[model samples]
Target: MIGSSTGPLTPSRVLIVDLPGPDLTPDQGRLLRQSGFGGVCLFARNFSTEKRTARLVSDIRDALGPHALIATDQEGGAVLRRLDVPMPPSPLALGVLDSEDAAREAGRIAARGLLDLGINWNFAPCLDVNVNTANPVIGERSFGHDPETVARLGVAWALGSEEAGVMASVKHFPGHGDTSQDSHLTLPTVDKPRSELERTEWLPFRRAVQAGVGSVMTAHILYPALDPDAPATLSPAVLSGLLRLDWGYDGVIVTDATDMHAIADRYPAGAAAPLALSAGADTVLSCGHGDMETHTDHRQALLSALREGRLSEARVHGACARLDRAVNRFPGVPAPYTADQRSLDTAQVQRWAEQALTWVGIPPRLDPALPLLLIAPISAPVGGPYGDSLSGAHLATLLKEIYPHLHTVLHDDHDPTAALSLLDRFPGIPVLLATTGRWSLTELPRFLASRLRKEQRSALHLVLWNADQAAELKLPSLISHGFRPANLQALAQALMALR
Candidate 1:
């Protein structure tokens, strides 16, 4: 399929398409090769088994050869890419533990996991500032609130990634945090002043650049101060002036999924690809499989743009060179079919989870004779393909394991009456464990705060399993932050201590 072509096809200018799964059809592989695409980004849904995923990556390499780069969004916690294998705790969990060393270890674990699966690039260690709790997208994916904390953890993550021979990409450049809306659905605006941005939003990115992160992905959000007209992905001021010139980030600069509503809604499909490349992004990530017409149109448009002198050949070559350099620097390590004994054991995972759970606040233990009330939410909002709802069920299972006899109340955060009724039923109960679900304190209604404060006399325990919401709340009552089911023991210990 990828025979020599004298026409408009060029490898440097084209990076297209994300398949639905690890098993790529021969036709799909052929199409990619013929289109002159330079890479593919993998997600959890794309992988069902590690061995199959490894074979898939190998197949892709054979089809596209050395020029094709393989990447995945494998940041741990809820955003794990390899669904077949176990993933480490999320960045916020590491942040809560306040241990850079742990973060580094997580990075090593994650990197090793990726390498074992033949994945060379990981879109990880999000550099966004989690200032907005109501933000639908980047809650738990972010490290923490303080820019310094994010920067420190991000550096550790990057170092750990490099140590394990995986290229790390610090993403949503210019920051995706501080926005309440999801960029995948709409173009969110960040109205912060340049000074505020420098202090908070840009801090972690600066650290990532210094840490030698191999890539930086641009956000689709618009910043009026930086570019009044275009989103960061299409803004020359953001990519060239700030990221490249000011920050001196010589690494590959990639655009987030071009198919997202943030970009798709704003520009014509034919125009988006060329505009993104001209704006300074070396690669454009096309996420979904929508219409064949759209793909063909974009490809032709890019080729046409290059021929007409709208998109420079030099720019495309420069981008390709950066990507090639990154690939060569961190070449793919063949998959290790055998699992490492240390990583597969659940004890180490439980230990890490227990240590991370310490950051959460636990109410004093009440009389053992009194029945304890555990309020759990049925569903929660989440980013990517997975929603926050699944994690809630997982937590419920964990809680049941710890306190089999405890009276458990389930409610939907959407229903105010449900929460009120639960509150009324459990007045002055020494131990009231409320699962805020994935929603953070900031995302919660002000009425909920008033209600919680009114019942302040009652020992209230809050646990944030979602990173985005947890980082947003910065809740004084936060009791635990981890991804493992065993973290419930720490929560139980903290609750008992309250008594």
Candidate 2:
């Protein structure tokens, strides 16, 4: 603890760290007991059955103390971590519906689920105004392309979370939507001018702030218009000048993650953590696997910076106080947070999913008596930077639920050979090709396009996720805009109507 006659600045108070496993080890216990340690952010590995997660949450609270800030990236769609309920539709699906009620309902479900799990903070309501169709990281995760719609839906989402007693953090501050690169792998830069950002990318965040959201997560993308050199996570011009001074955002500011390649490529975790804190971030989120030595190194670096006056004690203290306040904002751990299958609003999720389906091309005249050949790529990844675990398998299951006898072929690779071979085998059958918008199916889209131009075979394209893919490929296709189980279920229902 770096203390004077005044209270000490414990570096751990501003550190939101994680562990590899579910249960707390002796080392984790020791670290949690440290006056500086603030909270724990959980991941997929920390969960199993809902009851198991409840027990794990109890254990974490016991080890870290009752008020330790427990958080997770429970931002529905494919980003769900440990929650045991059926996955909800993507934000894009909600954007398609453009219903404040639907968005609020989605937020309520996520927040209620997190609250039930003894987790208080939800890093969600991704407010990025997705302007670039080719953006790899924030595709379906974003609400939509229109800033006003994003703002309206984002505020509703936050309100729902707050109503459910979960602290909602509107994320990727300053926007991560316009860039094509993924910050997890590389540093992504946004060269848009300040005027353009204010008109488009910055609107949703301002709306979220005005709506009284308690926290904002900084993006790792660099905005030359806001700060020429550093990314928003480490840029004082953006965090301090733009968000704090200009926007009057007084709530806690959290960094996305210090270990992400966007920051790691330049500043190591130990160094980046302090830089972010000094720049205006109240807490540094380090979610990846790190050793005890690494954690110690991070703590020491902050302490050193404070001693050297590179970092202000007042700033550290202010951050610590804000973290404490945020932790207290969560309702005291109620009965063990358990998943209730009945509690999940499957109907609303279905509604959002159904609304998301946008059909293109002439209505296919298909005979139910004949086989409906469904050629869905086994898995076309599109959730986030590292890709998603969800695949065509989910779509297959949903389709089979409706059309049990439907002929299904799962394409594992991007090569179009397998799909072409399947087409040859099932000669005049109406083929419904499921893709994920982008070239996630690799060369399959190109091959299909060429084949479509050469011949007409009653083929109707269906994009399981990634609506932007349909436009980018210049193909007439139906789009689901999301890939979660609920979204797949809705798509299945829509296809059943076609049948």
What are the lDDT figures for the candidates, one per model?
0.71, 0.76
lDDT of 2 at 371: 74
Q: Which lDDT tens digits does candidate 2 get at residues 31-73?
A: 7676446677887777677777777777777766655778888
Candidate 1 residue-pair clash tally: 13
Best by TM-score: 2
TM-score of 1: 0.85
Q: Show the colliding residue pairs in model 2.
A: 12-36, 12-37, 13-36, 116-337, 378-392, 437-469
Q: By summed lDDT, which 10 consecutive residues of candidate 1 come out lowest?
A: 1-10
Quote each prediction's TM-score.
0.85, 0.92
